[model samples]
Target chain A: MQLLIGTQAVELDKEGFLKQLTDWNEEVAIKIAQQEHIQLTAAHWEIIELLRKFYQLYELSPSMRALVKHTEQTLGAEKGRSVYLLQLFPPSPAKLACKIAGLPKPLNCI
Target chain B: MTTNNKSITCKKLLFISRHAPYGTSLAKEALDAILAASAYDQNLSLLFMDDGVFQLLSAQDPSDLEQKNFAAMLPVLALYEIENIYVHFESLQARQITINELILDGVQVIDSKTICSLLTQQDQLLSF
Candidate 1:
């Protein structure tokens, strides 16, 4: 599958994650967020940025438990709770946030 | 009248990684299994012996091979609450690797006797 951003077509996996991580940009993230019914708020961007940094560091996406621990370590206790993340990216935060951040599906998510 | 009830217990799992990081998938597979088992909140520990000690070497760059650098994942183990990482003393001596060459912090270097006791303490052993 592919996502059309203006005139460019960005390839995506069947699960709507970006096929090429390099193809991701702010515009691409906004487009993906729109599809997921998220409005791309500042709070959302914070976690998205965190997930991207996490991928760069570990070369893999994080499971929900890892995500929570990482956020707690990096962003302090206030924004680390699952409830805080769920409020920003509802339903499933880790998977949805990773998708919007252009990372591959988390291996241990299931 | 009497009833029989079973109690839930967390098993002590020990993962023994014996392969080099890049040569086979065993190293990565063991790491993945360790992470997956962390969710269960069980007693988990890791031992790196044989060629597996290479997985903890610093400055590992697998970019050319298009594989994730296994050393990079070691730090995440602490975040998953799988902290008890151990390295075989003889393995490092055999490989001519020093303690500073390892990437992860707080790794307990143990001799064969300690390893023997560690094995005996585990409720289950998962070898890679």
Candidate 2:
């Protein structure tokens, strides 16, 4: 069965997910993999999880401001600080994480 | 291999932006947010990007000028466990900043690619 979490429904099968990700017909999947260092396999599920949690709490998708503040508070100081969180997810960690997690992308994400 | 199923949480938020933390009241506001969030056991992290990194520069004499330098509040990070600090490597390089120039506490430097990867790993992300 295909799982529809946030951005869109993605199949659990590797090839199905790969095909769906490349449906953009652009190099986005490849670029994300190469530039963002996404593992492709693991990244999707992670994003879905993040997005679901964000929505559950806020009762809305995270806007940029919400995403940043939440990420900083949860991941930053809890560990070493924002640096590690940035290293794990930079610029828009919440967005990327949500994407990889398989959740719907935020409406106002940059 | 096991598939992972972790999600980002939505809790009280505190964002520490040292870079002029606010265009007008960025620093002051950021500190307020941090202090307020900390009260709720909320999540909080600080960023030292671009010119903001200077917020934690080692030595300071804000008192001599009568401008109560607030950087002192940074140390409270340890007590509150709000030590998530991030610095863009490119920004630092462009500014000709050396890691040694700042208060070397919980700061971390990240590259563009890694930053993108990190983004994909969060439930939320913000900038100052």
Among these predicted structures, which one has the highest lDDT?
A: 1
What lDDT does candidate 1 reach at residue A6? Answer: 88
lDDT digits (tens) for residues A1-110 of candidate 2: 34443466534343223334333322334334344575544434333454456554433345444554565555463533434434556656555654444334544454
Off by over 4 Å in 1: B1-9
Report residue B70 deviation for candidate 1 (angstroms).
2.2
- Compared with the true structure, the alpha-carbon lDDT of candidate 1 equals 0.91
Model 2: per-residue Cα lDDT over B1-128, one tens digit each = 22343223334242526464223566655654564455444455555666776666667446555443545555544544566666677778878878887665678887667656655544444544
DockQ (Cα-based) for each candidate: 0.71, 0.01
Fnat scores for every prediction:
0.56, 0.00
Q: Give the Å error, residue A54, model 1.
A: 1.1
DockQ of model 1 vs. true complex: 0.71
Report the C-alpha displacement of residue A4, candidate 2, in angstroms: 67
Q: Quote the lDDT for A99 in model 1.
A: 96
